[model samples]
Target: MRDFTWHVFTQTGDIEAYLLYKEMHNLGAPELGANAGAEDDEGNVADEE
Candidate 1:
């Protein structure tokens, strides 16, 4: 989907931006595709389909 590394410099050093990012990630945790397994990746779910 969208790249978050770019947000690191998007002037999101505030509560609103933090929450937005947090919520975005929270909703995205379930759609992480196939990179959900293995020790190399964390925060990743699975391609349950």
Candidate 2:
């Protein structure tokens, strides 16, 4: 049991750390892999200040 736990942790530790970092970095928006801001038909942001 102990060895199995250690093996799983060793294999997934880096992936877990990376996922945590990504969650932390992309705090405001979900990582949906697409542009998330408002846009206009002319390819400009309509809400630009």
Candidate 2 pairs with clashing backbones: none
For model 1, state the Cα shift of residue 12 in Å. Answer: 4.9
- Over the stretch 1-49, how does candidate 2's per-residue lDDT look in tens digits? 2233334557787665555555655664334323433343335545453
Global CA lDDT computed for model 1: 0.49
Score residue 46 of candidate 2 by CA lDDT.
Answer: 50
Q: Residue 23 of candidate 2: its Cα lDDT?
A: 60
> Pick by lDDT: which candidate is best?
1
- Model 1: colliding residue pairs: none
Candidate 1 Cα errors over 4 Å, as ranges: 1-12, 29-49
Q: What is the lDDT, from 0 to 100, of the residue 9 in candidate 2? A: 54
Over 4 Å off, model 2: 1-13, 28-49
